[model samples]
Target chain A: MKRRLPLIVVLVTAIVCMALKFLNLGERGTTLATDLDTIVQTSYLFAFLFGPIHLIRLHYSNVQKRRVNWAYSAFLVGVCAVCTVVFFINRIEGPVSTFIIDSITNATDSAIYAMLGFYVCSAAYRSFKLKNVEATILLIAAVILMLGQAPIGDAIIPNTSKFAQWILDVPNSAGMRGIRIGASIGAFAASIRVILGLERSWTGSGS
Target chain B: MDWKKLQWIDVRILYVIIVVCLLIPMFHPVGLPVAISDNTRLVYNTVESVPDGGVIWVSHDTGPGNAPELNPMIAALARQAFRKNCKIISTSLFNQTFGPVTTFEIIDEVAREMGKEYGVDWVHLGYRDNAWPATIRLMIENIIEGAINRDWKGEPLDQMPLMKQVKSIKDDVDLIFCTTVGSPGYADWMTYVSEPLHIPLTGGASLTMYSGVQPYIRSGQLKGFLGGLRGAAEYEQLVGVAGAGLAGMDAQSLGHMTVILFLVLGNIGYFAAKRAGKNQ
Candidate 1:
């Protein structure tokens, strides 16, 4: 029941969504799909609901067993209680809940985004060795693109800026176009598979 | 065999080189000049050509994680939209991230500075789940019945003056400009939103995601594209504007250059190691 029930629910939802997408099939399909979307959404909200329950249960059990940091349960409960009260009260659509939600949401978003800096830092460091001919080409292209993409590149080396523009406009676009074609082709194949019942990837097991 | 095996270089050196490269652009932006691509130029031109005080839909399908690229493009586009006194109907799909809200915040801020009134000029349709399928259904039926309004906080959308103009995704909007992050991202926006309806769609995306989305632009499935921060920087240049993309250009340029340097160094190290092993 743990796994199978969710699987069954998901398949029904996918089928309903697909049906409502193309076929009018009366309002029945539309209603089912909308309801399924709501249910899926509520399930996410339910996570917030169950989070405290899970934390309390595990922590209380740990306290009973006298686990380390068990005393911190009081702190945890206090914070959770405050948050819940705040969520419901401020959730009445005031700046209160909005502030809480937005700050946390924005901060989380910003933090994850900040990782790009580090990733690029690492990626560039690795790319420098020109591990092979491909690396060498990539190295050259990356430099030209980096230089051309900015105004400063022209400031330092004016012609390279123009050359970089050509690369970005023509070759980059061409390469990007090739990839886009490949992606659409892949999307088409995947869609066909789903329509034909050959692809049950979304279903996890069955549909 | 030892020659091949011995050539494997330590990974840490690469990390250091990339960091150094990344720092260069951070401190000094190269100011590379760019001739705006036709697609991006169209995005600007489209806004420019629109009737003054016209209504246009800004369909935001991205989150903050990808904001560094999309934000500047949208900012420049919004400036153009604002230039023509164009009304913006901003909506989003991936609402989990604060980017849409931030985008709306920017619009609201810009609009406020211009004495633009809310609902009079711009309306935000906050994040909705299952964006593609919901959007597809929305295109067929009216948005009043569609799932677009399920996540909003204001009084029911019917009351919003801005929403008064839009009957559905198919109506009341002049153009659909979607700045997206990655795949399973704008693919649906293109297939379901733009392709079926023939609404002109365009925007900037992250570099990693840019290569994959280019075909849509090529086929005119997408009216245009601003590929990552680079694309956004170019658009900013054309607009004769400066913003986050411009500020970060130095970082972007230096980062890319450093990668090239590392690639060369890594190859050299590999060949050297190979030759040393052969001599031994």
Candidate 2:
């Protein structure tokens, strides 16, 4: 019953959602769009629950077995409980709710981003190389683009300013555009296949 | 995977060169002249030709995760929209937590600097989940039914003069701008909204995903595209505004240049050692 219910929901939702696009219905079609958003919003609300669930399940198992991180069980549950309380109380209309939202936003935005710089630098250090001809060209192009992009490129290389501009527009754009067009064609083909139910990647209930 | 046996690239060398390239630009912005491409030119001209009071659907499809890169384009794009005296119908489908808030903050700040009004000139439809289908649906529906309780000053979409004229997504929207993390974004817009209806769509997306979105641009599915921070930098340049994109470009450029120099040096080192051994 549980499996059947979700599948029925998915199939029904997908059909209705997909059908709306094909309808001759003029202005009324927007009502379906509003309904679609509500579906997405509900999905997101459920996602907020997973963060706590994972933390609790992991720690609960650990504590029951007296594992190394067992003590974290209490900590995880306690924090989740407190946050849940605050979340429910704030209601987007409450000042406390605003505080909780702001706190999450700040940490996710600034703190997370601040740490990403180091990771990006580390990744660049370990991986960036000219292993072959294309790599060499890319490296050279990188220099041109980088220098040309920055204020210093014009100073160091006399004509780099205009040169960089040409590179981004012509060669880089051409290469990038080729790949993008290819991908889009592929996606369009796939979407058509899906609409026809030729693509069943999202199908399968037996497994 | 032997942890200690792994060869480590010299981190300090990379840092030194990156720092030097950045420092030089601070003192001498090298005046690297910028040239607008036909595509970028199209983006520029499209905005330039927009009739005054035209309504633009500006979808700030980026989160704070990509705000550093995409926000500059939004700022510049907003500047152009405002300068053209167009009414911007700004909204977001991504950044459920941050999408609406950040986009609004940016538009609000830009509008304030430009002396634009809130409802009369622009209206924020705010964050809507299920962005792809929702956006498509909204475009089909026209009236924003999602933002129910909130208002410009505790008012509704009907009360707002700015939104009154826009009955559906297609009614008054002159152009569609979808700035996002990658293909899912531009692709979604192309498939659901622009391509099917023949609506002109443009994009600003992550650099890594730029190539991936090129086909849509080539196929005329996308009118113009801003690829990564550099694209944003160019937009800022066109707007006569200097911000994070230009600054980041300085850093990104130097990093690229330094990596190239190291490649040449490494290749020389490899070849020299190879040739010396061959002779011996």
Winning model by DockQ = 2
Which tens-of-lDDT digit does each residue in B1-280 have in candidate 2?
Answer: 3222122546566566666876786776644545454556667777776678787888887776788889888888888889888889877777665667778888999999999999888888766545356545554555555455344234577877887777776556777888978534777877777776667888688776665665566667788788777778777888888877776776666656665565555555555655566879
**Poorest 10 consecutive residues by lDDT, candidate 2 chain B:** B1-10
Model 1: per-residue lDDT, tens digit, B16-129?
665666677667666555546566686677667667877777766677677667778777877778767888877676654464577677777777766788777777766655
Please report the TM-score between candidate 2 and the true structure: 0.77
Clashing pairs in 2: A30-B141, A146-B253, A151-B29, A151-B30, A180-B214, A180-B215, A181-B215, B142-B168
Per-model DockQ: 0.32, 0.35
* Candidate 2 per-residue C-alpha lDDT over A37-124 given as tens digits, one digit per residue, 9 for 90 to 100: 7677667668767866887888778777888866777677777787778777766546776565567665568668646654566564
Q: List, residue by residue over A1-207, the lDDT tens digit for candidate 1.
A: 754565565556667667777788876766776676556566756876787799988877877888898789766777677777987787634677667657766667777777666676565654455557886777677777666665556676776656765666577778877776798799988766765556665656755
What tier of docking accuracy does candidate 2 attain?
A: acceptable
Query: Chain B, candidate 1: TM?
Result: 0.85
